[model samples]
Target: MEESKEREKEACQELPSRRDMISNLPDSLISQMLSCLPTKEAVRTSVLSTRWKTLWLLVPSLRLASHDFPDYNSFVSFLDKSLDLYREENSCLHLELVIRKDYDDDQCCVTRWIDHVARHKVKHLDVECILVKREFLEAVPLSLYLCESLLYLRLHRVLLVGSESISLPRLKTMRLEQNVYPHEAFLQFFISSCPVLEDLSIVRKDDDNVKVLRVHSQTVTSLTLGFEPGDGHMLYHYFDREILGICIDSPRLKYLNFNDDVSKCQILSSFISSSVKVHLGGVRYMSYYSGGVVFSNQQVARSFFRCISRVKDLVISETIMKLIYFCMKVEPLPQFCDLSYLEAKVCLVDVEMLPALLESCPNLNSIVLDLTRPTIITEQITAWAVPQCLLLSLEFVEIKCCCKAELVGMKLAKYFAENSVFLKKLVLRWRGYVLEEDSVLRDLLELSWRSSTCQIEVYGPLKRPVRV
Candidate 1:
């Protein structure tokens, strides 16, 4: 009988302890743990136990998405109650609200929520409203512009009406994507208000109603500007408007990604650093069907190239390459004296211009060529002049074949293999299926290399290296 009693006791003791380990933590620690979760999920934890019921009220951060709730009223009610509880308990440091449904009926409520957060000394704020109807974009409250404690701010698809009281002194990073700005002067004023801004990204839509956008900041270090055009058929409408101009006067800028096709004239201040890394892609001035290049585009391309000529690293898109080809036809391409790394997408028809392009980058040490949209190779490949970098500084070359038939890519690879004297490594990435893999490998192996120590590697469609 005693043995049976002891066995029962042992089994009872061994049963998983019902004592909640997480609940024993202090209220501060529990609130911090809950801060990382969305407000809806954090509130759900209240049902776990009585101890967690009021713990979520002390969380210092709130992340709420409107789609998480079944109805709009429920989302608004939860957000209002949470913010009220937070105000009574603690200050919120971070707040992110993503509204995916239409909020036209409750636009005032949206503005009220933003004003409330701004009053609570919120440091980091991210608001994204994805409205299917373009006409019903929610307007951002003017009070948000006066948020003195803001350190980071990101807004998407919001209407921003400028106010003279704008001041975000502590804000360091700001991203305004697809937002409606009243005017270019308002944007410049808004940017000027952020005295310590460091990183800025502006993604413009087709009809944002702003032209000649000027980004003039002394403290900005990184800037990304892109234009998102509508469908192909609607591009003609956008092109009918006046050509846009972008003037950048940031002295401390180090990185710039300019991918806007809408802007033809780009002007940079003389204070731009020579060591800036630039990526020029998706910039074209010619019509899709027309074979003729615009004269204004040629001039703009030359001026743009001159602005970024001192950059150390450059990435060119296929459209930009065509623009360069046209620019070269008028005058020789500008010399990029400090350029060391280059990545470009070249069509098969423009393969002959690759050498001329490299000649402009005399100090280039590495190059990546993406051969896309391959056409038939008709003429002999004897038009290219030997570039200075091939004999001196060029060391690494990577060629990517994006089509099934890689005849042009193979010929270009052979040309590089026979020309680059100081080449260290050559990587050929065949992204298309090959019927005969062995023959492809044998053909690459038979190519004559100018450098005795050059190592050649071929990657098949599966991205695996092929060895003899």
Candidate 2:
């Protein structure tokens, strides 16, 4: 009877658990379910039953973030075991490691993890290793370039030091941040190898070796490049003498964004696509520098504006507006014959530059001017020939101005109301408190609208500003 009871117990254990529908599913499906969770939670499946014990090992993706581990040694041990146990022939891997202290042992462990992923067929990889030290630059493992199966790769704060040509034929999207390439030419060499790459983003810090960054990708349709202050470097480092120029030579490029101090860099682009959208900014430096530094940026400003002359939509930041103000004094401004939409950020000093810019954009349909200063000398409105947009094409005018009094607001409203002939709508946004609000409204209403169809909308301190 005891022997019979033992046989029944064995049979009951082999049967599926009560009310369990998923556990009895095929091994491949179970592994697929486990792969979606973090590696820590995925490992918990081993306790479910004997069949599920080894299923976590077959998960097709391994994600190990440093914060998931209680301590560094636990993180190191967990990564070692996961990679060793990962039985899937082709697995996708993602790692987000934060190195608060610069330690060589942690870096070596990262190298080992990268090596293991490269040997396996890693299809999609995203690794972000943040080196918290001010002077440390993390070295990316060379095996990363050998992973031909990688479809998307995004790396941050990693140094690419080798002279080897990085060939990843299937990569479609790539992002590199604070990556130290040995030379500027290495940046081009790395990009040229990816034949079908579609999207690329590069954020560079002050590099000792890279004087000029020339992005020459034929396949990239979208690109975003920015330069900002690094850990030990101040914002002034962006305008240092060591960094010289940026050249963009992509013929198929349709969209571009440039965020940096224009004072120090020369920008040159090959215009193949006549219509592109461009945002040029990083003008905050103007408030701090001496007059001599501002004077030197005139040529730099001219080069940038000339490059974007072919764009249809243009947004110029306050810094860029100041640059143009300086450039206009030196050279004849380039005409933006194709430009339709114009948004400009201007201070009291830059307001003088507007008529010239507006004259250049003969076909501008809508204009949004963001006034940076709270007050302007309305009496000193420099004379300008009537702009082509004011007479014919311009239908809408939006002004974002800040003021302590209503009179300061009236000066800008009166300028546009008097000029725009075919204007359909006039919108004025007052950012701060406007004293004598009703009088300001009456004054705006009293201003003569050039077009009979023009509608006036004014928002004061009590109301939220309208979107331009």
Candidate 3:
């Protein structure tokens, strides 16, 4: 038996080795594959064989993070050598470079690299420079605004100083997060220069030096505006410097996501499309009087709602729901004549307001409720006037319990099951820790649904099987 085993091992060793199929692929395909990897890891492929030695330099994209290296000097050296080789050997048709790091060593290093890439006709560039101290922010080179080859650009925690003649003709998507612009006109000019821009996202800080942001692009299709509160000592002065408002004039706009607590108002106009989708959250008004903060002013809230009343899809946050509930006391919500889909995040105690909000969307077809933060039920659920959509257009209803199961959520579910006339599917999802899982299922199963053919689907915790 030992002699037979030895003969078999010898025969296997005598067989030819397997071919390296991956290495045999075309250099263009191999470089494209390496482009998906980090620049450091891509460069390490050089040691694989002589064929791969110079292949990484041909990669169309480079993602460099300073933390990936032991020190800043090594990172700089690698960038210098790699980019030099790429410029000499590879075609400049497309190049993407992403740099994310805290560059405190030499501020000029970042600007120099950006200018170099801009000159080389970079197609995509993402730079996120985190500062150790928030007092000083590095400014992007003026040359970047003139890179006509750029298609996508994302900058975070940088200062954008506009030039007299800013030109990025091919730019399609741009994101500016926590960036500092010199003034409001500079920002408007910066955005107007991108003639073919389609998507734009801006995350404002408390002291971004822009009071009233105006977006006046005729070609933009999607826009997202959000706010980030200051930290530590800056929080003490937050209430003193709230943003006045935002004005948008994009005629081709299809989507808008507005999430800002500081902005007092939002004005949207020139919307030619009636099928716009809107996501609203953290919109409120706070007044500082007698050394205390008070939230009031329903007029601002009402105006905000009216601006988005024509949207086809609406997603409202819990804070905005509370504001709407209070605003309803002073004035009624505008009719959402075109709204068909609604997704709302509400607390259990605030579920009573859901029907009133739904009544405004007369043509609603689907509703998704994200229920959370349950409070003790002390009073009966308020009787709501039946919404027009519930009787005619409502078809799909989904209730997601983001927290532990509660009687209020079940009651809301029961209310929908019995009220929605044309409902086709009712979904109930909850966590597994609730001891009343079986009881909840029994109650739902026994309820008399308004729709004769309504289908009920129950989902428990992911660890457990689905209970129909």
Candidate 4:
């Protein structure tokens, strides 16, 4: 009888009704969902629910890509309608353009739209042009660069003519993707122009005709450097395009991300200023680059970190962590390093190099270790590689991924109980695969350790989530 009742309950359990679900969703939630879709499709949602009637108007983000338009005139007409429709006084605007046009119609439309938006004073703008032919792009005036409300701007795959002519005064995030131009001349023009730019990213385009790519920027806080695949013939060309230009001169830069495909390129800061901090993701790679480049995962990590030669607060991917451990155990390292707050995602910590790297961080404050999806065996943690003083200045410790908390997890618990004098909080995030109720409870309870000083928080069924 009980089994039958359980089956009935299970049968009754279904996803919330679509009407009920739509009715219950808040305006903000609806707007956010609509924002991700194409602008036209997003606008069509007004008839879905009366509650969402005004939601599209309130959607702060507007993403209109030109690729889907039937013709240039259609794109221009839609742009005019959208600008007239979306009337938020203070909302972020995300404008991405992919114009593959040989005609002057789309070019004129783009400029008119940019001028219209600038007059409205949009908060955030990200502009992208996909292979915009030379003639049309050259005609765009410098007025787009003068907008004060633009917090973000991204230009991609466009012919950079009068490189010095483009400038943004209040840009917080700027991304230049897949652009090829003469190296030093390229940056001398751009860097000297943008006065208040903070976060900047430069990605080279895929072409052999381009010989050099030079980069120089001042007052940029966050930077991302990425590379596109180059034709083999261009590799031996007269101009040494092998050197990737990365100039992060911003005094307030706190985070950095790097990606490269050409293994031979020497990454040089055509010029670097002193005020940089927080290097994030020292190495980044494209799927094609991974196949062609000789840079081992370790070598890639090494190059990435070396670029951000300045500062603290770092976030590392699991792939990068694996490489860093390999390189750190190798022969040489500069004496006193400053990386203190490090966040890593990995199942197993490299025991050998972990201690040495920690030693470099004398004034380390916190360590956030996020476990990858596959559960790392508790016994495999290189706890001993962790220096004794690692937990001394550390105030917060977090551990994740436990099917059933075992040896390595226990070692971590004991380490905290014994060594952490100032340890205030310990967070354990639970994994989701374990199915049975009893087994889940047992696995969850297994982490509750024999500790007194630190306050422990388990992430599974018993307590609040580790994440806020």
Candidate 5:
């Protein structure tokens, strides 16, 4: 029985092995197959056999993702090791490098990586340039102009080259990102040099610099531009003398969008340029930088009233209203007073502007006052008497951050009860400490007396979900 078992085992072992020897596999075939898998998986195949060993070194493309590496230095080290071990099978490379670090390191390493890929005759490259450190001090050089063989390029969170030129002869598509600047000059230079370029998308940075970014690309048939400002620092560089501006010049621009602040960048009224007129008629949507900067002076506020026609809908910041009141000294309307919709940040001075503003926007209907600081609002709104106006289309009115002594709230409720002819709904969202509570209630009740016939909803302290 032992002899028989041994013979069977020998028979099984003697059978010609079906698996192909690693050394016998064609290098080209293995390399091509490895190229299809992930970089990690491709490298893991080397453990199978010695012939498969060098196959991963032939992967034509390398991707060192940011999320995969804990830090930039680690990613750089991994990249260096991978590149050092890379074999000739990867004659031409299609590399994508995305590093999550500061722009400084990106500025330093980008050129080196680009050069490495170019040396390997890389054809497709997608890289996310980031700063590792020295974020404010360093600048990225325009060395990408040397990648002649690159076919597709995407830049994100990278420094913008003011006017440096980039020529990618084989390049077909160039997508500038949304998060950071892909400077107008750099884009212009890139497009100008890429004669055969077919597709281009510049998801523009958020800024008010209305100096149209010149894009010269007749060959670019498909263009998508997010031309408006973003949720950038509205008050950033508060002390800086230079106000940021965005100027775009793309004659053949087809798919265009200009989205305003994402509801957070309360840039106040100064960001609006009355002298500037945008003639982008066929625009898909006029979205961004719409609200305003907080005006510190009444002159600025009054000027805003004149130009309110330019803005579709406005969230009047509290500061701007104060500025208006501070500057308000019984002035007449500026000129264009066709404002229809307004969301005010209620202040005492806002009352001063309201007389003229309401008079001007005769077509005005809805007004939302967003009040954050109860004390400031109380003082601000209390300072001015209610502007008398018989609003025709007026229906909805929301008063937030209401305190008892906020004399403006009582005045507003009283005024509306007296004058808001077409008024249908009013939400009084109030908040205050113990002593001020009764005063607010009394004021609201007084306003109610004015509008026994008008519908009023009072959200008093701890009454409704009228969070300040």
Candidate 6:
């Protein structure tokens, strides 16, 4: 039996091994395999064979995260060893470092790591730091600003202290969130430094010192500006009521999201802009109850809508709905020839602007109206003529409201059912505020359908299923 086992083992060793097939792959492909793994796991592959021993060093991408290490000291040691070994052989195309600044040594290590990557020709760089102390004065190394090879960059919670001059020649996309700047000029200087930046996002925190934000990028296509307040309940305490102004002048800008509640907006240029699919004037739960923002009679929102009049797709929120309602009475809104889809909230006080708003969008196709609360339409409907969109372009209609308010909900539903010539589908969902009979479904089915192929579907309150 021993001789038989020995013979079988010898036979298996003599046969060609399957592991040799993977080992025979090209060095470039093997390095790519190591690139997809975490730095620690990639280094562990060294025990596989001698061919993979130096394969990790040639990886074009490196991501070192401190959370994967046991302690801050170990994390620093790993970065020192890995970056040194990687620098000797080849340069990296992408380098991402997610570090936490808990100790004083962490800032020094991060500075050195930034210096190392700048010299190694990193094309894409991202640094995310969680500052343990809010008042930590660690500034990003000035060497990072001079990295001409960067194509994409994103920084979060990193401070840019006094180093005003920035010259990133090849950068295209950049995002700075919770990053501290000395003043508004520093922010503008950092933005204007990138000549070829196409997509940019700036999120301002409560600690930022800038009062007025001015964007004058000629090449930016997508831009988002948001403000984070310090306190949730008390808006006047943390937010400056001085009416923050946002001046924009990007001719090539296509997508813009100005979702700040505490600021006033101003557009400098009359450039054609693309659409944004967002809830325009919605606030957080705490902000809603606090009643800190009031745009009902403000001209700031009017200017904002006038600038984005050429938008192809629009979504109006409750606050913006009120603004449009009030603004329509004073001045005529810009003709929204580019608008194709609109989602709006129809309330009691703002129903008068519905017809006027629909008239502005000559090319609108679909509309969704939320009639959840009881809207007291005290004034009679004045306009009897249907809009041009309802006759030619409008197709899909969806309405959501309470079942008890069927009288008011069906008024809009009957209008759509009788008017929409090209209507494709109409969906109505009714939830009950109190126990009431769901006669809406039966009544809607009996309405006169304008389109030949319009399908009507209704969903009532869901009933519990009984188990046998």
Q: Go through the candidates in order and give the clash count of each.
A: 0, 1, 0, 12, 35, 0
After superposing candidate 2 on the true structure, give the runs of residues whose Cα lies further than 4 Å from its correct spot: 1-71, 93-99, 102-106, 132-136, 163-165, 229-231, 234-238, 283-288, 291-294, 329-332, 373-385, 401-410, 430-443, 455-468
The count of backbone overlaps in candidate 5 is 35
- Could you give candidate 6's per-residue lDDT for residues 258-328 as a string of tens digits? 55662244544446465444346434322222464443434665666777777877766666676566567
lDDT of 3 at 414: 83
**Model 6 TM-score on a 0 to 1 scale:** 0.76
TM-score of each: 0.86, 0.79, 0.86, 0.62, 0.48, 0.76
Q: Would you list the C-alpha lDDT of every candidate in the order shown?
A: 0.79, 0.72, 0.76, 0.56, 0.54, 0.71
Worst 10 residues of 1 by lDDT: 285-294
Candidate closer to the true structure by TM-score (higher is better), 3 or 5: 3
Give the per-residue lDDT of model 2 (tens digit) for 1-468. 999999999889877655367877898888778878877798887998787787887766766677666766777787788777766553545444443323644444656676678767777776676654434655667777877888888777667776575768889989887767778888878887888888888777676357788888888888777774566766555445453688887878877777776666677555535566777766466532564544765666667677778888888888777767777777767998888888888876567667787889998888888877655454555254578889989888887776653444467677778888988888877757654456666777777768888877777777643322
Which of candidates 1 and 3 is the stronger one according to lDDT? 1
112-145 per-residue lDDT for model 5 (tens digits): 6665666666787777754332243223344566
Question: Rank order by TM-score, top first?
Answer: 1, 3, 2, 6, 4, 5
TM-score of 3: 0.86
Clashes of 3: 0
lDDT value, residue 112 of candidate 3: 74
Better of 4 and 5 by lDDT: 4
Top-scoring candidate (TM-score): 1
lDDT of 1 by residue, 1-468 (tens): 999999999888866554577889899898878877767788899998788787887877888888888877888888888888775337777889888764556533667878888888889899887653457677788889989999999998878876878889999999998888888899988987899999999988756767777888999999988876532426566555456778888888998887865236467444446778888777453443244634446676687788788888888888888878777887888899899889999887888788878889998899999988867764666456789999898999988887753777777778888888999888788767753456666787787878888877888777678643
